[model samples]
Target: MLSLGVRQLDDILGGGVEEGSSVAFVGSIEYDNVILMHQAVLEALKAGKRVLVVDFRQPPSTLLKELRNHGIDYEPFLDDSLTILDGYSNLYGQGIQGGRNVLPNPLDLGITTAIIREALQGDEYDILVIDDVTSQYTLQSSPKIYIKAVVRLVNSVKSLGKTTFVAVCSDVFEKSDLAAILIPFDYVVEVSKGVVEVKRSLQPLRVVEPKFAYMRTRNGISPMKEHYQSLEGLKAQLRAGENGTIWLKDLRVQILEEVTERSLIETVYDFLGPEKGKELLYTWGKKQFIGYGEYSKRHNTSIEEALEDIFKFTIASGGGKLELVELSDSVIIIRGTNLFPSGKGYPYPFHPNYAGSLAQFLTEFTGERWEGEETKCEAMGAEHCEFVLRKVR
Candidate 1:
């Protein structure tokens, strides 16, 4: 038996999870299912089990950092007890080299299968951790094909007497589709609305009566008594997950499209003219900030705290790293590094979207109308972007 490291969860599972059984963690990103995966990994490692992590979400390095941040000593097990199959770099076409198990092409099912087989050859790993199964849908032409592939992979792992722990975002699937996907797993754990329940249990079947409720903190999961103290505290556990979705409490935001920095700039300039395009982009940014500000106010969050939270959210979503350089009654200055929306080779200053965002951030925070301008931009040969917001009139 492999323990999940949580006492209540273990008892619910009839002491512990069965070996060679495939367990599916079904949930949306807000529930911190990824942390559950990390906890399982730590437990498996402590039990002297060699683990294989097939990551399809983020860069393996970033995943490792998060695992470490959760206080899991994964580094010591690296290349020996732990081997990560990086599916992120190749899937995104970065082709980053120097990983033990780097996929040449993640979209190719055959390559993916062969790589996992190679890693599992000779009973090398006792546990298989697929950080997520939802990402496979993005690679396949049809959902039916990917579900078959998942079943095949799970069956193959079980054949080697290895355990499988996989995560699936329940929100991304239809009710029928989710049921179909869960059919292969021996155990299905559903995490939703701060409740962890055993949705399916075939191996020595047991019921989780009264459903286990838990609150996730930075350290780890804790069994909740009655209810969460703060809704905003729950919202603070933001995560970017499967299908390019960002979760904030119950809100699900999807990234609809991807455009290159230069193309976005040129297209806007050509379609709307530079001045109108800039104005439109600025309004877009301001609208985004205003919506967030309103949401924060509704939650009874202080403006200062809301500003900091938005900055962190921006960085987490790959917007950029922002630092408050200066703040006074009349002026606010923000320094941005590696701003994702800014192009490096442009001949002129080009970050009106960010400038507009800064203006709205100030206007909403201070209750004073503000105008913002980009004083320094990487597009204009500056090392970083600087936005200066001054009170209007």
Candidate 2:
């Protein structure tokens, strides 16, 4: 458990971030997210741990002066532990050794990577801060590419048992999807006006603080603090999981009695390795469906209608090949095979558009993914017994 500079904030959050999580301080220039992050660093520094601020957003003087004025001896903060990678977003270098700052060219991540790698090699720091990634978001042509690399880098840091947080602003992105995609976050934090709100997925959303809730009641900072309530509400949703994702699929998918739906959707696949975007489609034509007991009064008409809907699409358009060949009548297997269509390759070629979407969906929805070529299988009857390796892909 880690503690923020403020005891209350740390207590509200799960004692700081879970290891290897890319925490985000999603705030813009006016929102004072930088100040909040500084406070977090102050807490870490007070704990006798080193802090590093990868400052692509601001010059050191102003922020250092601000902290000094706050009765903080920021010079020591800057002594050897605190790092300000000022102007690196615009400073393009040939490599880490090439310290020449070429502002005209794009930020050279190759150079930045080497710098970070060398710094990380020394095991002295516990927390790193990348404040306001909007500049980096704008600097990169495709933000996701850079973001994936950054997450890998963060993972490297976490392997050493350190913590890292990136600052992001909602308005920084043209679309929310891109924001969600870019930041590989374990938790999301929003600091608006003066208040800080904390939320976590795979955990709980705790209202750590109401920075401006009181100010709003007295007199709000229109436009600046207008989103205060909204941010708080949005922060509340963090523990809830991915903006309605929790309820978007309140799916009760119990594959009972060895049904087709059970056989198709209940399968599990490994979820590690470089070969991501792999998928094994059981069928691709339409949304899948199932049936109920024929004479059971409890059987609703909708089940049959839904099954009919599933059958309505023919092989040409709907029920394409089930990724797995008929293996032992009851058990079938498929390995992800396509990268573009799905994030991973599927056992069979899927419709180009739907492949990637479905692979990502199943992984998140049902903890499935295609990892290696070899797969282990168990019969529907032998649900407990496993271990038959089959070469896939």
**Whole-model Cα lDDT of every candidate shown, in order:** 0.75, 0.46
Q: Report the CA-based lDDT of candidate 2 relative to the real structure.
A: 0.46
Error of 2 at 117 (Å): 2.4
The 10 consecutive residues of candidate 1 with the worst lDDT sum are 225-234
For candidate 2, write residues 190-279 as lDDT tens digits. 767655666454355343232222121211121222222243422322343454434212332221242443334323233322133223
lDDT leader: 1
Model 1: per-residue Cα lDDT over 48-141, one tens digit each:
9999998998888888788666666688889889988888887775435555588777778877887887677777888889888887775677
- Tell me, by TM-score, which candidate is best: 1
Each candidate structure's TM-score, on Cα atoms with residue i matched to residue i, is 0.55, 0.46
Q: Alpha carbon lDDT of residue 98, candidate 1? A: 51
Q: How many backbone clashes does candidate 2 have?
A: 25
